[model samples]
Target chain A: MTQNLDLTDIQGNIVKAYGSSGFFKARYLFLRVDDGDKGRDFVGAITSKVTSANEKLKGDDALTVTTNMAFTYAGLQALELPTASLVGFPSDFVMGMSKRKDILGDDGPSDPKYWDKIWQEKVHIWISINGKTSDVVEERYQWILQQIKATGGVTLLRGHCGEDGNGNAVDDLPYQDASVLYEKDGVTPTAKEHFGYTDGIGDPVFDGQTNNAARVIGRGKLTRSGDWVPLATGEFILGHVDEAMEYPQTAPRPDLLSNNGTYMVYRKLHENVGTFNKFLDEQSKDYPGGKELLAAKFSGRWRDNGAPLVHTPDNESKAEWDKKFAAADDATQKRMLTDFTYNEDISGAKCPFSAHTRRINPRGSLEYGVKDAFHTPGALVDRRRILRRGLPYGKVKDETSDKGNHGIIFMALNADIKRQFEFVQQQWINYANDFKQGNDKEVLLGNHSSKDPGKVVLQVEPGSGKPPHFVNNIPRLVETRGGDYFFIPSIGALKLIAGGLVDPT
Target chain B: MSNIAGKAYAMNVITPIPWYKVWLNRLIFWAALKIPNVLNGLLTLSLIHYARWVIIPRDKFPRLDPSQPKEDLNYSYMLFFSNFNGSWDQYVDSFTFAIPSGLDLFWKMNVKYPKSVPLTPFHNYIQHNQIDTAHYYNAYPMAASNDVKSAKNVKKALIDFNAASSNKSPDEFLEDYNKLLNQLQNDFGEMRPTPIVSLAAQAVKERVMEEQRQSH
Candidate 1:
């Protein structure tokens, strides 16, 4: 029998509560079992026992279990269980959604004028389980892999950062698997993405019932704390949502949201360190200690405040930054510089829209409630989040190194890859007029591949009635390489993969 | 018994115990518990001493201890070292109050001699100089001297040595020196924490002078 419990006791929620500030690092692993019978057996054994090992494994108290199933070529079926599905989601899931609404759109072109300025595309990865290879499976695998490598792991082309360890640009270095590891926690399997920023944060939080607030009663409705309910397994895994069937997204299925089925996307994007430094140097020439200013602008906080927009380089001292309220004293002036929120300032004057900080999280005015906020199409955000798991691949090279290489391996966990992550990349940052308000794109991470020299304007002051200064010198920080989608099976699937397939004996 | 064909075989065989393996397992088990405790205890004590002596004293106002010797020999056991006053304290804290002549010897050992050399002052400074200024002259001249009684020759020798060591001309040396001095003046003159160290020293000096005054 199934037991009902608050999400607070779940493994992911517990981790989030404790992980508030200290080094926020996490790794994600994805695997495709060779044999279904063995995989199912392996997965089942671990899931049945994993709950007791939560504390030892640094997971939350909640033991997660779900089964996502899909069809392979020639009617062969498969199943997966994502880490996000097993882990209780963090509050940031909702916060990130609200912020995403600010920059994205539900339909059509977002910023029409800049449409020609930048291009946003996705790469996908498809791997064929081998030795026992099927032609249909191989065809799908090559197609997806090629796509990912070509796009930047959005589809599946192999992409590595331009520079290599010896400092020479491997003009021909093909994108490949960044890194792989052995057994996790002795029995579990896992994988790491590039770029080291816990990729799993991309996963979304879901409310179990169809009606989002049906589970919560009266007073708890609007509160952020009240929103902390365990997401339904269907939100992340495919067949887990609807136990009876499979192929939820296909034409023959009853509903688009499948049971225990999740679409995952992985990518490896290279950050141009040399280009980044040049941009910082050029931008900060006018300011004293301009490098620091650049650092503040990119990080969104002085090394201390840890909040990107709330703090700036000029007001780096502790006393100056701890301004929760306006002060009249000499100490107050220093504190006033970083005392406001993004709600108070929508313009990219203080924090550039395309900056890594802004791209990672642009809160406030961009949320759902604000005017001009983009409406995310189709699936409500509750079912559309992804878990990002990637790491830095290749040796970090210095400017003098002739080898151009190094980049992040990016991964995301979502019920629908096309609707969630890919949608965000294409419709929000890359698609002009997707928001229908202005031609503004997140200039930093946004792709400006066109010849017109990708242009983005930033308002230096909020509501100052002055025109935003257009700065065009910013270069690409990340480039897509290659990656693939893999199903992390439930204990049942692990048993199937480890044990003999169809153990009729 | 039976002595037929292959009969006379031993029925039971005796085997020796693996005593060392047993002992190793026991040692590991005991060490697992004891080693951690010992290491933790050491760490705790070091932290406690650091907090009690360094952080706490600095946080709470510390009074200048003139009567106390400059060096606290117990400092070797401490985890926290005073960034600046540690070496100075090592000298002044070892001062001898019983002998007046010890003051002259103290200056000669700590001030005139470099840190690498052994610090043994002359046995009899009284015979060398009765007046304080005479002692200063005797010590300073020699400390600055390659050979005694030739200040002019010493200056010439220093200039020659500097030129021999450097690949650049004298003009380049002066230019570089002046540039470095300018930079140092700009950076250290305003930003240096030297004033804090000097203030600490002055506070100690005042306490010593006050004691001397009271005695007088």
Candidate 2:
């Protein structure tokens, strides 16, 4: 039976976007609590201020104040909570990000000296504030800072800056001092990361959540006909039955403490935009279609219009692209945003299996060569889905300069960190055996180890008798600046912590 | 009353493996058997010898009983481990419903040592046990190879079981159970496990070849 989700008990940012129009300015404030009693008092003060999942703001110019918060394992320990209560939490979360650096393959950064300073500090609490305008965001930001200060907590990191004058980021921002602000391109009006691909597409739809748009287009080959089913809610929430049909091992609780809570993997990924552009410019010289087509092949989407390469193989004429969108109604257009699957492109002729999107999601293409391949193509990928809520950080100042902190503040929510997030990062993105292709890495997001220096091979299917596209000696495009695992607890859990009323028994 | 015969019998029994023949001859001769009686006595002795030397010993030390429930067994345990340098799904599927050669060696150890039941029952028991283990890991059993939906349905069943188990009262559990039944009917409509031909032996053979290559 589908369990009813208590939306009010969940954090707002987890279930839906607070800034609905994608035009709002946001800031992330990382904090460290010096006093346990004061931290509890601070939590008590902010419990009512934090937004609930029930309140979803809409409209292009709606000015609203929304604050969502999360805390690290250290943050909870700093609050004088019983250590026993933290048991059953994933080791990755308990150890925090710095200790799990080896497992994440973030042991060495591209600029190790620069990251050395970045890893010295740790953030205990993360408060995210989003408002329609910069003015509103600043107002709430200042208010949150004052609240943190009153509770004997100091701000560890404060980054606040909007998109560049050209609706992009300046390339030379410091990795630690700034939080890259994400906003839609003024001209295109679509949210894009530094790489210019349409961002925030293909988020998984979970049961009992109001957001169902992904269901229309994101259903894998597992679904038949009109039977659109959302993934089990437990995949993203604690105290709920997960895909495994059992409640994931969770932190100790009186049902109220852990229920509706979820774990957040907050990553600060610094993008090497300059190197990426240069690579594309040089590598595409001998290619058939040049840089634009090569970029599309890498991302699996056309940069300008976000048209999937699988659907539109070549860059369509502007008029033809307009006609395609014009023909679809509002609902159909919305569904078209994330609706396509790899069922027809099983051989990856249209979209290379190593493309960033194909590696991360795979959709229905993972069943090939696996036992019972025909029965359920989506089975392999279903357990690995994560609720992604991320935005680009830093600005690309000089597209030619490879020395910037511009990238994504990659955020993901999941019930099982190991099964969902880490599985995709390690097995699917980094490893090549599961795809039945040779040893390769994801073209865009994969961390190409310096030791092995993995290659990216795109198989452009037969009939032309052309050899596959091979790019050798690929450099690591993204660097882990710093990251930490956080627990976004329910409002009830927050109250319990704040009041010091949690019963250990 | 038979002092003379008892002394002769004691003396005959003192010989080693040959004492069996001497005892048999003495019994047959002492009974004053005719040709038919001698033939019947020899046949009976042969049958007794077979039962004592083979069947009783075999039954005394049976192989590991995989069918024995977890609660019943006091100390029987076995651990299986394998390292596959390839895909996890493929590796797990390779061992499904079939014992690999290495495992088969262990399975057949009882033939010489005589510790467990017959091969067929033990194999069947392991196969059934494998299905439960697969479900624990949220994987489909080999028998349901063609049924892709079985894994998802098993997950749903587990969810339902957990929900019912959480209920504090019989009424609540019944209510949850009824709701789960209705959900199964409505969501999946009707579900059944689709049996598929076992390719377990083939998978095991492939694994064995791969392992041999790795060793070299």
Candidate 3:
């Protein structure tokens, strides 16, 4: 009988939905192992153990990392199904993401730039084992950590190596690793990139072994007592049961049920904040405080999740905000959002047509005309969900710095990439033409809003069905430096990674 | 088996049965093993990318939207979406939510009909098309006991029906609906309203057209 292990149950502690402060920003590292045989042998030995543990733990079942390994055993293939077709040989610098240190500089004792050094980031261990045995992989993995401890602290940086147009060995410089946690007075806002906007306002709730009854009230309660159903925990945190269900191949053992989570995909996405700001400043000449208008166009809400649909400059009242923003029962919220045809807010009266929130979540309006509209089924929304983890990398240098490299290491997890992150980016962010009423893309990171090379709108005009109006703030705020997929195994899998295979022991 | 393991002698040996089947088996094994290896190697390369020539190290990373309120979040995105519930039944049995209790008798006929058979007579359709609700309920081993009971009732009723009798033809099923309408009309007598089936049929017809256009 074929045994395929599912790895979706394992939850990442810090989900991106809830806002992050510090200590939790994502960092990335990429590397490439030399020999396919050694790497494959290494991976197979390690992955089987990890996935098996995940099978026990009920973790994420994506072969994001292993499929790219040098050699994959047929047995392992039987376990994991390939979603994305492999294109070519693996590169030397395979990448991984992580959280930044207390500060964004190299601070180890030996090298003044130790924290930023490339070598320090790598988790290295020596393995002299072969075969497709899970034991060998686990042993070597454990030994590698021990080796890291034996050696004093070392910095590992990730970089790329390829031939240039002239066939020259083009090796990009190693990135200086550092976290945004130590930025004094500067708040590392737990926000999605570019627009300086808050995201993941509402997410599905999940109920597992933990007593999360407090989180469920009103319409939040879907299933009865001990009835398995989906729940929304929060953003940037682990998601709900329906979300988790997408990743498994079979039922997970009860012992591995609690808190076991999945691996995260991390990438550094660069934002052209300066260029975006300049464009918005140039276009919105008619609006009073055009920059703020620009911010409104892209963000949909004025920095505080407050929508412009309800509040005008003359009528920006707290009572109005409160009246419009009441978090009612889930069914009410669902009805209010779903039953609408045009953008829920007509005339862009409350939220603009092109706000980031509406672009990513569009809650009700996107599915308005479709069949089975009321059922916000998993198939419809799973593609919209992304496991966003990562943090702001690099510094402003000086506040007056002309250009800087800063961006988010965006991460996502889903059973089908076509349905989840890709669809959201292609269909929603880039192609979504309708908003609360109609028309316009998110001004910040969306394609429609960024159409004009020169104009950057912080907020697009309401119901205009045009690109976001430009705004000025920072330029090139983030950039897509690089990215890669990975599969994090359960504790059992980790043990397999640490233990070398045994000959029928 | 013991003798085979004991003597590690010949690399190749001939079997009397057939060469083609042996060759086919070898081809299948090699293809299964080699293709995965090639794909795995290439996929690993995608991970080894760089931004400005720096290697990104692996470690614990963040997940989900980092800007929403805590109360709004139930669990992490990965946990919520991943296998946090620790079962594959949810995914496998996801399609079992509805099992033909409504007036739309011929719903989900595609699943019942195949290319070879084409279509079934209307009365016979109900028996062959009867949804085994118990089978659907049993699909999820972890489902609640109450759900299992209700699903069993639906299954028993479906299984007991004969294909040649009640649901033998499409026209017969429609006739049954008409009979029910007449009964309702007579029972109510005082007040009557138009049935919902015709409206559904119209809507479905339009949707099929739209689907055809989209496919092209």
Candidate 4:
């Protein structure tokens, strides 16, 4: 609503979270600038090589190369940038992970200590390179590494597996190894996290992007008459009018550094595949509809095909639903992907209130509170929408003995870190009661601490006058391994930092 | 036979008038409620709808406006951070009344409240304030003086508010909030209380002084 985005000034990653970037493979390199002068040179070098939002890839043969970077508070300081330059940066970044650990719930593997040891050091730069093929990704990564070596910067942590110079198995090496490998069941391609639920289903559609038709039908609340509208762009990007019809607070000097720049919450989430499988296996035996339905209930979607549980309630319709989903046209398929709202299933008869998806993005269901409790059907949830650009790391081994380090590089981009990311994490994912269901945490993907024994209750209404089915004591499935708050600066801002021209006053 | 037929036609025409009028009356009633300013009655009804359904229901909490200069807005924000205490529900209920009441008081005091004042009584106050929770983590640290001490007090007040407000009636909750407001005013005085309370207090004080001068 404010203005058209300066695509050329913005980083490619911020504009498009790269879910559609056909770049099936990616490697994240964490770097620490050894010397300020050398770091500036390195930044300049990388800034030239970095792709802007306006970059256009020609064809399948041309590798879709995109590089975007962000700095920690220390990273800016390490580069000798002035304090004035850090104005709009969130305090979490300034306090660093060590100080903000309490609110982040990063006491476990996600603990700052277990974090890529480099992150603990005076690490300043984070470079993410993504490409269609691993070979292209490797080639680009090596060239960037060579430049860093020449410039006196050191690579702190390397995520994803690829052969080192010694030809050792990348998987065999022990470090913070995380990867984005595709999961396909024969012909159908399923982009899933280690937990086996299809991931990245309902990303928020912003204005001025392609996929207008899909955005119109899929975005915002679905009324009883079956109409929809896109969420305000300011909710995702900086310098735009949000749903509130007001421009969101920018990170200081709107025109220079803050415009088009958004904050990214980089998280490393480890999935306990063995524990999850065992719990589901044991619980499904006593469950009313067994493992398939139980998994659907937990995730709000069918594990095999990302069909929503609201659309297909039981396992009996699984085969028919799968076939229908597979046979549908592109438009029909896109509609199936995000067209459904919780209006009809207000009681959570189909999708439980505490279901992972429902909790994260309640959509229209949040309106079902006390009279005049919310502005509109989905108004309460509009501000909290995040563009998820996460990729599953680690290979899933056998269900029982899956013991290797595997999880997801959970990445989310939003305009305001506190309002969108932290609010969703703390209120919806960790705490309960906003749903008015109970003290139940999100059934899956919640911060269910072992000490707390996070309990989840599933209410299933069959409508036959019979009592609703209730499941409790759902175990903690995902754990925060490591994460940090970063301000992904605009390309121009990056250049300013690289040139050491940022004025403090 | 002709006379009998003519009499029957007249009876049929008269019979349909009441039924048509019944349907018309129902349409008029429906239109009065929904169609927006059909009559003066509809206009009044629409205003009520706007107030209850739109303004009250929406999240009106103070937000950081990108358009506004940062340095100027920080004082009010500091007060906002200083004033908050307790569970999300309590905070929402507090603001639901506090914001409107504060504005009403401000208006009564004949002070010009900023145009941005209306943003404070939001629909999703709980979620909006939860964002302030990031301040606890120092995610977006306020540059205000004594922020750390102020934050600690706010957290304690939140716990106290939750404990006090739970299971209390609306009147009971209001009384508790009033006590909290007084305690905050006493504890911080002019130095650290929320701007809302400070402004309202100043307004009331000024009014009293004027009244006393007139009496003299």
Candidate 5:
């Protein structure tokens, strides 16, 4: 009942999460097509540069620099894709993220008006270049600039004309940079985001997505008999049957045009570090376990490392748990980071019900009350799983200021946006009653306004004899600055769009 | 507060149906009830616990009190209610996907009803007409609809196994128990409490525990 994913068909970044591949520096640019023929020529020129899943990465032909391209609905239209092919695309992708704001809860301060000035006008194409070093990233970006220059039809879409410290206009290249956070030595990437958490743990392992067969244990679906099985490849990739064992009705046709394609949700989330720290400082006062425990309660993961609260259980144990992590072997360390479930702590004593990670993944915890309720505990969540394809954009220069340009470039890859991505945002992150929290939002992404007066419960085991602390006045953690949905087409589809071979008739 | 009981949440939606289409809608429901196979796609969706549709004709609006004004409506109203597991999005999206034609046939005649395609408009249509449940009750708060049905099979298997094992030797009884386990492997697990039903509930439990500790 499983089909081996055609690795050669998938786009490079879709298969390989760039950070782990030692590509720390990334440059992102959007290009708009002014002339159709030149746009097609531009696509044709970049076709060879676009990395594929089967590209040789480890040896002499090593991928020192990686490039990938995706298109907005407007971009596809600009490329002059046929009407039939265009109409077959999913409604969410066609509507773009800004138009779907109501469904996405992108209201209040996170509205489209607050987006990056570049997003004021919709752009046609999105281009990303990832590299091992700054020189490589810049070189690739410059080469792309050449392509835009050479093709008279294409032009770089610029962002806010904000001044650099020297009083010179910045974003002149009309690009954004996202790099992995580095340790103080600044030589090695720590894979930590601005918040000082060891991020990117527990990415889903679909069948045939990677060579790491062992990843299935913690990353894959847990079956009725307690066996770990990889999820259907179709959950993340198009042209295949998803968890529902049915091809989505919206998969674009002239089948080759949509096959191996997936939707990417690009969001610029602004992290209010100062507000977060101040809130922690304020709330940790007169608290039993202090700020560390409160921080753990927010995400269900220890901020020092990515250790789940399930393993630590309490403040003392968590402190000790962090120490053992570094000394452990690769296998043990990976297990410590990714493995474990919320079933044992059924009351959310260890991991609060509204914890950010729990709200996002839930990881079969939603069915914890009754074991074997479904053949697989994660049946409900399996379909909603999304591949997080994002990186932290800006550096944290000042830790004390809530006002700064520092946050995550949160991109999500999914087969169905409305079903998987939108559902998670609307049903889990924005709303309550799903996790039995009664309108209380997830702590980190709660978008808490003063009127709502962000309040939440942090519980300890009843056996510990501590009353659940009701934390009050939680502040907004993240706000959306800009983003839209883009379609990462297969190489085959790219060729079709480039050749003007996509036919609806 | 009462709409949710453990895994199931009750949803109620009432929308006006055109007078001309009311009978046709009723006929569709009657056909679905009589010919169960027509609902094969819906039954396959698996999340729905129970669903029913009722039509109240414009003239049928009840008038009980003299003080209450008699109803004179141009359109009959159709009421749809269901108890289902998971979030509202999953329930509706699954319904739309599982049985697009069936959903259209059921909701096709309602006033300003959008067809169940290009999802947002359809979602808006339902949300516009939906009414929150004031009170809802479920006998098995800890179990899903499937759990309740499986429990029945488990009970029957246990009764038969108990009767057959009465006269067996120790080894034979062990063998009989293994056979019983094999027959009901899926029904072996018991339902436990889901993490923190509500913060209010957790607060109450914590306060009671604190008081007990103080008294002790």
Candidate 6:
């Protein structure tokens, strides 16, 4: 990779998504600062321990546990940041997630009141402890608790692990735990979400971010020349030039504080597995090819193996794909998982146009039937990519009931929350005009509480002479439990906040 | 979407023009004002309640109070306001696709104005300078520009029909009514509260409701 970033300054989470890259277990802690001086002391103490985005760990150098921290607008204000620095921040970050619920398509059941009590209150500091195992996660969690206890300046906000299968009381826990789902054997881990679809497949690779330059194809912006090169660094990191050819708006004074930093969208999305399972079961009954095919249509991937429907259109071919993917080498398999595009199935005959994955990413599918719709293939999609993190929380006790707290602690890292995370949430997931799917909300993530909960159209296979399958009256599969926009600043920024050396002049 | 009132979206964009280059933009707007046909492409689109450009010279900025310091800005500002009937992207893409040269002519003099052909840059440029209206008001929150025009057309047609053939024989009046129906078919749509058909429509409905609530 050319143009290496100042890895020592950036947060390690931006460099690598800890959840996807081996850190299966994670603990998230929220804290409030009543006293600014003591808060600074706590920050100073954490700054030294906080992980930086250094080189990728290989073999023996791999970390068993990693720590990263971020602050909400309330958190920064609680830390007594200068007004200039605070005002210089973007309006969205200033408003925080609670105030911007309408902009985020969060209403009705996903309303702010429905959120966990921790989210209902003002959260200042967010501490994430990620590790290779549950024990390691607990160790780091205890260590952080010790830090909070020692500081005496910041109050540890009781977390709401409402979905944690441990039967923890709501808003009474010290921290929330998120872990990757275990296979049927309960030994091996899988990358599937509560909905049983493989999520977090193709996050964007920006310049100077990752060493694997080979991972650009279908992961990075699709170029007019058809080469899949890394996106501009500023798309994910501050101070660097972005896809818009402008440095991202940063806190002006003491530029070092804002430089090498990025914004994080922390959302606790609770998946209603019972409602989801029931919907699929009922829909698949009369579905032309039954449950498996219907499941693939709901998402754009085969449920059992996460094989993209664009790669394998039908059951017979999906069998072949499973074999090929199983036999392929590590590099080939990695490439195979995310390399497919919408160039083949432009008509949505294979993968439905309104499929959750297809609508979310599009993968240059906007140009399938409508030629010259975009200046470049996936030009609009490229700028909106977010570095996906977070893990599924709680345990699924009953497979049929919507109760009992199980969902994903969804985390998104990006340069601009409004341009990246909010745009994706509002336009792509909650609305369907961009995908030419009329007003259909995404089947999995759409806010479906209104009189008209949107529908999905599964385009029939070409030459089959069958009409398109219509999946109507889709329910809200996921809800916003609670979360907010956070700013994961650089190492230098933390020091500035700690020392109160943030001179806007 | 908050700028939306019924089917109309009020877009306000302010871009700085270098003092030296202000005359070129002045000449263009002036020429368009004189030759109204210069905006025929925009008129044909029929997507606006009102659209105007006001140029504020750098030194001419008002200082309302004595305590308010006099401004010392180097660049004059071009304020473009359009109350259009579509989403920002729809109106912009239509402008770029239908009248690229027209958009270029209007915005080319402004600083960092990208030519409208490649849309990403152009969209960003407008969005960067575009100001969201904190409070927007429309006389008719439920009527689009088309609705107003169609209503006017229907009224005029009805008056003329009444004046020309009101006292005709029954058979003759029936023939005249048929002719009138044939001619006025395009103006037959009834205006009502904007439907929640799309994302913007939903926003409009909410905004209208909010305005109605506040008024009460």
Best by the TM-score measure: 6
Candidate maximizing DockQ: 6
Q: Residues A238-306, candidate 6: write the lDDT tens digits.
A: 988876566776444558778888898899898889989988998888887779888988888888877
Q: Candidate 1: which stretches are off by over 4 Å?
A: A1-55, A59-234, A238-261, A286-289, A295-305, A311-319, A322-341, A355-364, A367-384, A399-405, A432-440, A450-452, A463-469, A494-505, B1-216
Ranking by lDDT: 6, 5, 4, 2, 1, 3
The best candidate in terms of lDDT: 6
Instruction: List lDDT for all candidates, in order.
Output: 0.33, 0.59, 0.32, 0.59, 0.77, 0.78
Task: Please provide, for model 1 over A392-489, each residue's C-alpha lDDT reduced to its tens digit, 9 standing for 90 to 100.
Answer: 45544465232344556555655544444644564345532212212334454565443433545433453343333344655554554333343333
Q: Residue by residue across A296-387, what tens digits does model 4's lDDT show? A: 89888888768887888887677777788899997788788687877667767788776888888877665453333333456456667898
Note the DockQ of each predicted structure: 0.00, 0.02, 0.01, 0.02, 0.03, 0.05
Can you write out model 2's per-residue Cα lDDT over A357-453, one digit (the tens) per residue? 7888877565452333222446456678888887665668788876645777788999877667876776567654446443366778777756756
* Higher-ranked by TM-score: 5 or 6: 6
iRMSD of prediction 1: 32.8
**Where does the lowest 10-residue lDDT sum fall in candidate 4 chain A?**
A169-178
Model 5 stretches astray by more than 4 angstroms: A160-173, A462-465, B1-80, B83-89, B92-216
Least well predicted 10-residue stretch by lDDT in candidate 2 chain B? B6-15
Q: By the TM-score metric, which is better: model 2 or model 5?
A: 5
| TM-score of candidate 2 against the unseen true structure | 0.68
* Candidate 1 chain B: 10-residue stretch with minimal lDDT: B2-11
C-alpha RMSD for every candidate: 32.7, 21.2, 25.0, 18.5, 13.8, 9.4
Q: What is the TM-score of chain A alone in each candidate?
A: 0.52, 0.89, 0.54, 0.90, 0.95, 0.96
Backbone clash pairs in model 5 (N, Cα, C under 3 Å; residues 3+ apart or in different chains), count: 0
lDDT of 6 at A161: 52
Residue lDDT tens for model 2, B1-216? 110110010000011112223344344334434434322321211101111111112113254696744343222222232212222222222222111332332323222222122233433444333311221221322211112233466577767679656755887776665545433321221112111111243345458789999999
